[model samples]
Each structure stands twice: as C-alpha cells, then as structure tokens.
Target: MKIVLIITDYGSFNNFLSDLAIRLKEDGHEVSVITSETRVINIQDKFDYLAAGIKFFYVDFPRGFNPFAHYRSSKKIQKILDSIVPNIVHIHFTTGIFTTLFAGRVKYRTLGTFHGLGFPVLSGLKKQVFGAVEKFCFGRLDKIYVLNEVDYKAVKALGYKNVEKYETLGLGCDLSVFNPDNFSETWKASLREELDIGVNDFVFAYTGRFVNFKGYDKVIRSFLKLYSKNSKVKLLLIGGNDPIHPTGLTENETILMNNCEGIIHIGFTKDVASYLSITDVFVFPSVKEGMPVCVIEALAMGVPVITADSRGCNEIVQNDYNGYVVDVTDDNWSGVYEKMEQLIINKDYINQFKSNIQQDRNDYDRNRYVICEKSRYEQYSSIEK
Candidate 1:
C-alpha cells in the first residue's frame, strides 16, 4: 500500500516519525512524508529518509495562525495528493490537520494523530475558534489516534467514535538508544568532566524547545530557588530557542538562561540520551503535552522525573513512585520548588525512583510503537480491499 504521512515541519518529522517511516518501508509499503518547508532540513535527515526508501514532499504550512498561508498550503497538499494518490493519508499535529481540512474531501482512507490540542492552552476567542475547527476537522477523518487520555476524552466528548489512544504511551522511546546500560560509568564521568560538572553534583535536566508553554521559565525559576539554597545543584538545558513559535520564550528568560551560572544551556544536539545518562533528575514543567517523548526517554535512562500534573505527564508520573508530579498553575511553581528540595534532602528517594523505573522501562520501547502502527495500517489496507 502507498501511504503518505503529513506533519507540520521537518524537525518534527526527524524527531518523532522518521523511525516509523523507515520501519514501514522495511515492511514493503511505499511510505512518503509531507511536511512544511519551515525549518532548514538537515542534509543527513534527507539522506536517511532517502536511504530508507521513503519519499519526501514539502509544502508551506505556517506554524502560526494565517488563513491565507493555510489556504495555499492546502492547495499544495491537494496537488501532491492528486499526484501520489495514496491508499492511506495519515495526518499529525494541528497544522497538518487544518491544512488537510482546507484541501477539501478525498477518497483515501483518512486518519489523524493529535499530538496535543491547541485549544487546551488557548482562552477566550482563540480557544473557541480552535475548538470549533478541531471538531470540524476531527469529524472528517475516518479514524483518529490520540496520545493521552485528555485528548481521547476530548475527541469522545465531541461524539467522535473512531478515536483510539496510543497504547504504548505517547510515541514510545528508542530503548536501544536511551537504555541506561548503554552508557558506562567511565563514559559518563568523562562527559561530566568535559562539561565541568562535579561528580557529586545533583544535575537536573530538561530536553525540549525553550518555549513558553513548555514552562522552561517555570523550571528555571524553581531551579534558581533551589540553587540559591544548595550550591551543588546544576540545571542542564538541551534544545534551542524558537523565536517563530507563538509561545517562544521572552527576552528576559532567554537572557537569564544564557547568563545564569548554574544553568548550562547546550543549545540543541541529537545525543539527548547521553546528557540524560548523567542527569539525576529530569525536570519538565510543560503546561501541555500529547504524551511527551522526553519523559519516556528519561524513564528509559533510569532517571527520575519531576513534571507537572498535566494530561500526558500525570499518566506517566506516579507521585512518590518513579517521580513527583506537582500541581502547577499559572505563575505558581511552589510545588516544583518543593519537589526539587525533597529530592535534594532525601537522596534515598532518587534511588527508589530509579529502581522502580528499571522495572517499568521496557513498556516504552519503540519497537512496540512500530508494530502497533504497522498493524493499524494493515487493518486499513485490508478494509480498502
């Protein structure tokens, strides 16, 4: 079967769906990826996809709200669809869904995977508008896959009956890459020395775009408070700033991230698992997520987490078990600070979380995700026949 997967940008494709595309191609299906030409596509990313026998098609789907741009993107998608005439069309993210909606109706088996709904973070007019658009687009799809209970409930609330939750929890992590056993103590110590981190330092790490809704600012604030009290604490920030995003970090936050002494901002690197290996605690205070892959990766690395009580996060983190899930609201991050302090004071708790994580880590292996996705595609193909 010829299948086409649509997403927002090349970066997202590289991060989330590249492995799936490769696996599908290995399964003897012709798979192609369609994404907006927004970010600069890495040459190696293209080479990897081409080598995997997957095709690439680019369109301009603006990340932010712009009706004219979306219309143009939809027309471009329509042209591509006419050319490819795929047996299956699978959309991902809000941008992909909205652009496909503008392309009008098609005869292909349509499916969508909502990473997270935009309306949950919006309010007033924006919330109402996005919510209505989501319902309309959702109803048009033949099948829908959601990452978290919040999204599943939201789709069901809209009376959409074909929705199913991703059973592997989020998109699943590459266990082979993120496994703690892969990194030896010698290698970890050498990397720590290179980064000027003391062997005994309590490292708190976060890996994701430094955007507002991600709550990096909240993480920073809490870390700062902890650092003031305990000088042995260090914050490791992976990933870079997104000035184009609607919720990009403020000038003050960016400046602080750069100037802070205890916080090490290592822009963006593909080797997130390496950094996670040396981390004692992974802090993610994002206000919203569709089942954060980073959290799963951390768990796979045997690192405990301190995250917010949001939809996807709440499901992964059992309070006082693998990690602590704080109830974060607006500017109130006292709970985050308190949790950090608890981990600092009670060192035994960290070991306990790591022990619990070892037993539960296999549940997030990426192979499971690949198998589940392949089965779904085969089911659709059989139906088409």
Candidate 2:
C-alpha cells in the first residue's frame, strides 16, 4: 500500500516522518510525505528523509486559515493525489485539515489526526462559527485519530462514529537515541561542567519554539522569582526564537529574555536528548498543546517534568508522580511559580518524582507507540482503495 502524509511545516515532518516512514516500509508499504515549503529547513533534514527511504513532496499551503487561498492549495493537492493515487491519505495539523476540506472527497481511504485544538484562540462568536467548520471537516474524514483526550471528547461531542485515537511517536525523539541509559552519570556530570553548571545547581530546561502560547513569558516570570531567592537554579532554553510561529513570542518575552539572568538560551539544535540528560527538571508551561513530544522525552530521560494543566499534558504529567501539572490559565502564572518554588526547596520531592519516573520509562518509549500508528495504517490498508 502507498500511504501519503500531509502536514503543515518541514520541521514537524523532519522531526516525525523518519520513524513513521521506516515503520511503514517494514510492513512492506510505500510511504511519502507532503508538506509546505514555508519554514526554514536544514539540508540535513532532507538527507534524513532520504535515509529513511521516504519520498518528500513540497507544496505551498497558504499560512493560517484562509478559505480563499486554500482553494488553490487544494487544487495542487488534488494534482498530487491524481499522480500518486495513494491507498491511504493521512492528514495532520490544521493546514492539512483545510487542504482535505478544500480538496473535497477522493477515491482513497482518508484519515485525519488532530494535533491541536485551535478553538481557544478564537473569540466567543468566532469560536462558535468555526466549530461548525470543524464539525464539517471531522464529519468528512473516513477515520479520525486524536492525540489528546480533550480533542477526543470534542470529536465525540460532535457525535462522529468513526473516531479512533492514536498517539504519534514522540515527534522529536526516537527512544533508541533518547534513552537515558545510553548516557552514564559521569557523562551528565561532564556535560554539566562543560555548561558551567555547579554540582549543586538545579537545572530547569525548556525545549520548544519561543512561542507566546507556549507560555515562555510565564516561565520567565517564575524563574525570575526563583532566581532572586536562590542563585543556584539555572534555566536552559533549547529552541529558536522563531518570530514566524503563529503564537510567536510577544514583547513581554523579549523583555524577560533581555532582563533575566541565570537563564541560558541555546537557540535551536538537534541534540535535545543530550540536554535532557543534563537537565534536572523539565519545565513546559504551554497554554495549548496536542501531546507535546518534549515532555515525553523528558520523562523517558528520567527527568521530572512540570507542565501546564492542558489537554495533552495531562496524559504525560502525573501530578506528584512523574511531575506536577499546575493550572493553565491567563492568571495562573503565579500558581506555576509556586509549584516551581516548592520543587526547588524540597529535594526529597524531586527524588521521589525521579524514582517514580525510573519505573515507568518504558511505558512512554517512542518505539513502543510507533507500532500503534503502523497498526492503524495496516487496518486502513485492509479496506479497498
């Protein structure tokens, strides 16, 4: 079977598609990825795709939800569909949702995986209006897969009968590469020394784009409060300050970055696992997410996580177990601050969280869950194309 995946950006395709392509190929299926040539992509990302035996196709999908321009992008997708004539079409993210809606019905078996719920970004009236559009899109797909439970409930609320949930492999980390066992305690100690971190210092790491909705500003405020109280705590930021992300950082983020001390910003790099190994605690205060891979990777590394109380985050972060899940809202940054402070003062709690994480690392392994995605594809392959 030939399966085609449609996604919004090259970065996501680079992060996720390799393992997926390998999984499909192992099943004797042909896999190809279709994405927009919008974001800046690395030349090595292309080689990664080539190495996985996956063919990559690029198209220009208009940024954001524009009904007018989407029509033309849909026509382009239709042309690609005509040429490839895939047995299964897997659409990802919002842009892919729009492309599927605009392209209309097709002969192939179509599946959609919702990565995030964008309704919260809209106003009351606009949200209700878009809700109808969302329903239309959900209704059209032959099968639906959602990452987080909130989206699962939202789709169920739409009363759709053909919805099944499947969590994609941690989009960024392959467990074979990210496993904590690969790095020794001495290696982590050496890395800390290399980064100028003292043995007593508490390293809090955040790995994602510098987007406003990710709530980096909130983390900054809390980190400042903690820093004032104790100088041993260090914050490491791993992603780029990309201004083009829909929820890109605001002026407040710039002010925070400029004013804050003991905060190390290491732009973006492919070596997130190495950083995760050295990090003592992973802090992610994203306001909206659909199963962030960064948090999962942190847990797999046996580093305790402190995340925002959002839909997808609930699945990975077990409060007082592996990490703490503080309430996520506009006025709850202080609540986030309080939680971080509690972790800093209590070494016993951090040790407890680490112990709990060690026992359950295998549960969140990337290799284990990619099988779920492959099985779904095989189920779709059984149906006549």
TM-score of each model, paired residue for residue: 0.95, 0.91
Q: Model 1: what TM-score?
A: 0.95
Please give the RMSD of candidate 1 to the true structure.
2.1
| Per-candidate RMSD, Å | 2.1, 2.5
The TM-score leader among the candidates is 1
**Which tens-of-lDDT digit does each residue in 267-362 have in candidate 1?**
666788999999999999887798899899999999999999888888888889999998887768899889888898898999999999998988
Extract clashing residue pairs from model 2: none
Runs in model 2 with CA error above 4 Å? Answer: 39-47, 120-123, 167-173, 245-253
Question: lDDT per residue, candidate 2, 313-352, as tens digits?
Answer: 8777898899898886765688778888888888798899
